[model samples]
Target chain A: MSFVSLRNVTKAFGDNVVLRDVDLQVDEHNVVCLIGASGSGKSTLLRCLNLLEVVDRGEIEVDGQTITNGQVDVNALRRKIGIVFQAYNLFPHMTVIDNVTLAPTKVRRVSKADARDRAKDLLERIGLAEKADEFPDRLSGGQQQRVAIARALAMEPKLMLLDEITSALDPQLVAEVLTLVRELAETGMTMIIATHEMSFAREVANKVCFLDEGVISEEGPPEQIFSAPQQPRTREFLARVLAAGRL
Target chain B: MHEVLQKFFSPHAFRVSLPDVWTGFQLNLKLMVIAEVLVLVLALAIAVVRGLPGRGATPLRALAIVYTDVFRGTPLILVAFLVGFGLPGLNIKGLSTLSNFTYGVIALTLVYTAYVTEVYRAGIESVHPSQRMAARSLGLSYWQAMRYVVIPQAVRRVIPPLLNDFVGLQKDTALVTVIGVAESVQQAQQFSQNNFNFTSYVVAAVFFILLTIPLARFTDHLIRIRERRERAQLT
Candidate 1:
């Protein structure tokens, strides 16, 4: 069994099928990137992995545990995985430090002091230590997003999911957030990124999966997938990304 | 003009009725305070229950929905009569013999809770669903997400509206008089009937105005602060 595995996973909302018969595997500490067009099920796939959206039919096993089983504890399962969003959904009412420490203290039952200390350290690492006491609304988009990443990391999750974390950022601000992801990759934090940044994927991903119409049409190493895509759909997506100057 | 002022706002009537009106107003104050606390807690519970996700909570949500719908539609005076006189008429032993004050509290609580529950539900809905998703994605349970993230933002955003409802509650405290409870309006009515002048009613209105003006201003201040935060990203 791999560190993380999804077998025949399918999810739908009413008549709109978001994911269908998706199979993927990730070894511990490997950075896998899912690249595709919008509405291609990238975000939904990550959401299902975290159990934010339940799979209509499939088996998802994380760390040898079959999380898709009905009896599994979703909260405890989510504690092991951290997922960040494109919009950087930091709690607007909470300060930066409070946002980071909330899950550690409330969900994991860590002591408040310990959570605060860890949150402070994570903020420092993310280069937002000075913005600790400031409310999220007071921060710039990049700063808020960095705080959000720190908030997720504060829990020390086993696997991180980055769901187009930079898609909503200003073009100039994208690098700072990606720099932190690269640093996390260097530290060997296992991550599955759903992103549109093809060049970033090419540089940072161990493997890339091209999702087309709710299915992983092709999967392989970044070098192979980006340079020599096997499927025509993969070629077309890369061509479009290239034409848009993203790759 | 002087005669009109003298009839409605006479010094003699004000002085003669001040003591009695003030005493009666204390009962109104008590009802407002007690009812406000109960509505604050009970409304939030009903609102949360109404918002619980999945089919498992269908019955519970239905119950909460029915409660809000029934109470929201009933007039406070009618509720006061139903609770005040009707409960006693039910002759349900221990509960039937309860004081009119307690009955007044119950009526105000029921009616105001329905109104406030809608306010709280509106506030909760105003918070972007993404906020709840982010909280849940971090391993927080649904209630935990509501407690630590959603409700706080929702409550904060709706403070002005919540206070607006409170002003309505404060005013409606007078409705308890219909239940034969001697709140300020009833007291003022007595003095006005006896003296054949409405100055005592004017005196009661002044007292009510004093409390609500401050609340309205505070709500405005909070609104201004929130607006500034959104517009300028201020600290």
Candidate 2:
């Protein structure tokens, strides 16, 4: 079975349909980058993976464990899946170490010493050991996002979901977050990232999925998806993204 | 007139007996403490009940609304009278009851809990839905979210307003005088009546101003700090 699968996933809000009949899969030990225009359901799809936004109808399975039917204990399901958002969403009142340590202590039942040690290790790995004592609001956007990554890593999640983590940062700050993501990719973390960073997607992702109107327009190795996309819509979308020159 | 002048200019002019003042002050302090503690607990209960999502919320909310409105909208004098006097007539047999002092505290809690409930609600709602989602997604149940994440932030945000409510409640303890609770204001009045002078009234005014001004200024200072931290985050 695929490590992560979304089968016939559909999401709607009132009269607006955001996603429909979406089927996708991510194998273990691979990075899958989802790229699309704004409001093309990219972020919504990532949210569904972790069940942050409940799907109207569908099944989402991570590590062959189904969570979308609402049968699974959401906290248990979420413990194995980590999510980082564009806004960083770090608890402003908490220090970087505390933000990273909270889930491990609460969900995993780790001792305070162990949680603190692990948080410190992750902060060091992210080049943010100096920030461990600082509250999130005191950190730069780049540093805050790195702390967010560490916070997610503290849960020891098997799957990490990235929803435009760098889009909210300054242009110079974007590279630092992307570089950290690149390091995660190199370490064989199974990740599904929804992003507009075409260059990073082209470099790190083993596979790329181009979503349009809540359906995968094309899916293939990064070479085929980026260089010679099969779908005209994918090409047009990439053309616009390239012209924007953010990559 | 010379004797009056002598009384005014004597070193004993402002001499308040510590034992006597302490007795009245202790009672006043006790009443304020009791009323503040009860108000916080009752407000928390009412807020939780109002926050619940069921048929229970309706009646609890109604009760909370009526409790707050009747106490806050009308004078505390009326509520203290109704609780201390009016309830005695019903005299439901075998129901052990509260004393005038106890009823006064209850009355203060009932009135101010509603006011503080709104403060808590505003604080709780000010927390972005994302914060709750983050906490829940991190494996906290709803109650756990409130305990570990939401309530702490809400309480922090509501502190200044909650303190203001508390100070207001402290001052309102004087209203219990109608029920014959000898708190500071009542004691001061009695002292003045016995002495046939306004010295006791001036003393009470001095005591109140001394208590409230510093607290008001301190809360204002805290609010400014919170705002400064928020503004610093933006930059």
Candidate 3:
């Protein structure tokens, strides 16, 4: 059984069609990298998986439970699937520790003492324990994204979604966040990332998917997709990324 | 100078009866306090109604727009007259018999709730939609997200504006004097009428300025804190 699956998913915003009859699957404990040009619906696809953007038509299952079409309680489904955005959307008024602990304390109804201890441990794991009491404003973009990751992990999600999580960071800050994601991959956390960092995608992902105009144009092992793509579009994309010296 | 002192500064002339001043001050405080509370509660309700989900949202928004436009378009003194005198003549049975104080409270609440509603709406909207999404994605219901996350931030965001509104309420309490509610300003006017001294008028001005200046400074301090936090975020 697939750990996560989307069957015949379709989405649209007004007259603009975003995703059309998209089907995908993620096995447990695998990193799947989705690469696409601008406006290819990669972000929209990730949002649909988390139910942040509901599917107009189709079924989405996580750990074999239906989450789309109002059949499943969205709150319960979302708690099992964590999502990280390109922008580190940390609550500005909250301390880092507070941000990490909020969901567990409020939604999970965990005791304050347990939440605090767990938050501290997660912050330390993300290498920002000393900055726990500081506000998100006080951290660098790289540090802030790490805190956001820690915040998502506090829920102990079964699957995590990364929507170009490094794109919004500064060039200097990008390497640190990618490194963190690489470590998470090594730990066998199931992840689906929509990203432009082709080198990191090639290095860390087991499977590579090239999304073109809201459809998966080609997909294969990273070795085959990066160096020996079969589709002309994928080859052109790789050439541009290689000329830029990234892939 | 001696004549002037005797007329305006003599202990007998300047000495106000403690019981009368105390009674008047308490009534004034009560009026302002109750009016402020009522305005805050009603404004929040109106803002939520206008912002709530559904087809009814448009009509609620239209009603809020009209209420705000009419109240803010006219002066509070006019509202006082309509509530205190004009409405009574309609002899709406039970309503006409309400005390002057009750009429004053009703008028002030109606007038200020409109302004407060706008303040609250701006504050609630100032919080980014992402914060609400973050809360909802964590398994909170929509109302839970609003009550715990959105409202707390909204309250913090609008504190300076809300405090400014409170100062306006403090000064607007004097409008009740038009309805014969004997608050401090009205009591002072009565004293001056009996003795033909302008000192009572001077005292009233001093009292209001003394009360409002500190609040203005405090609001300034709060704005500074907010600005510093914003700057920190950017840098």
Q: Can you write out model 3's per-residue Cα lDDT over B72-135, one digit (the tens) per residue?
A: 7889999999999987888889999899999999999999999999899998898899888878
Query: What is the C-alpha lDDT profile of model 3 across A1-247, one tens digit per residue?
Result: 8898888899999988888888888899999999988799999999888788988998988898888868788888878888887888888778999999988988889999999999999988888999999988889999999998888999999888998898888899999888889999989999999999998889999899999888888998999999899999999988988888866
Put down candidate 2 lDDT per residue, A1-247, tens digits, no spaces.
Answer: 7899999999998888889899998999899999988888998998888778999998888898888777888888888888898988899778889999988988789999999999999999999999899988778899999998889988998999999999899998998899999999989999999998899999999899999988887999999988898899988988888788855
Residue pairs in candidate 3 whose N, alpha carbon or C atoms collide under 3 angstroms: none
Output the lDDT of residue B82, model 1.
Answer: 93
Between candidates 1 and 2, the one scoring higher on TM-score is 1
**Candidate-wise lDDT, in order:** 0.93, 0.82, 0.86
DockQ value of candidate 2: 0.64
* Model 1 lDDT, residue B168, Cα: 95
* DockQ-based class of model 3: medium
- In candidate 2, the residue pairs with backbone N, CA or C atoms under 3 Å apart (3 or more residues apart, or in different chains) clash, namely none
CA deviation > 4 Å runs, candidate 2: B1-22, B53-74, B87-97
For model 1 chain B, the run of ten residues with the poorest summed lDDT:
B226-235
lDDT of 1 by residue, A1-247 (tens): 5799999999999999999999999999999999999999999999988888889999999999998888789889889899999999998778899999999999889999999999989999999889999998778888988998899999899999999999998899999999999999999999999999888999999999999989999999999998989999999988998899998
Model 1 segments more than 4 A misplaced: B1-3, B233-235
Tens-digit lDDT track of model 1 for B100-150? 899999999999999999999999999999999999888899999999888
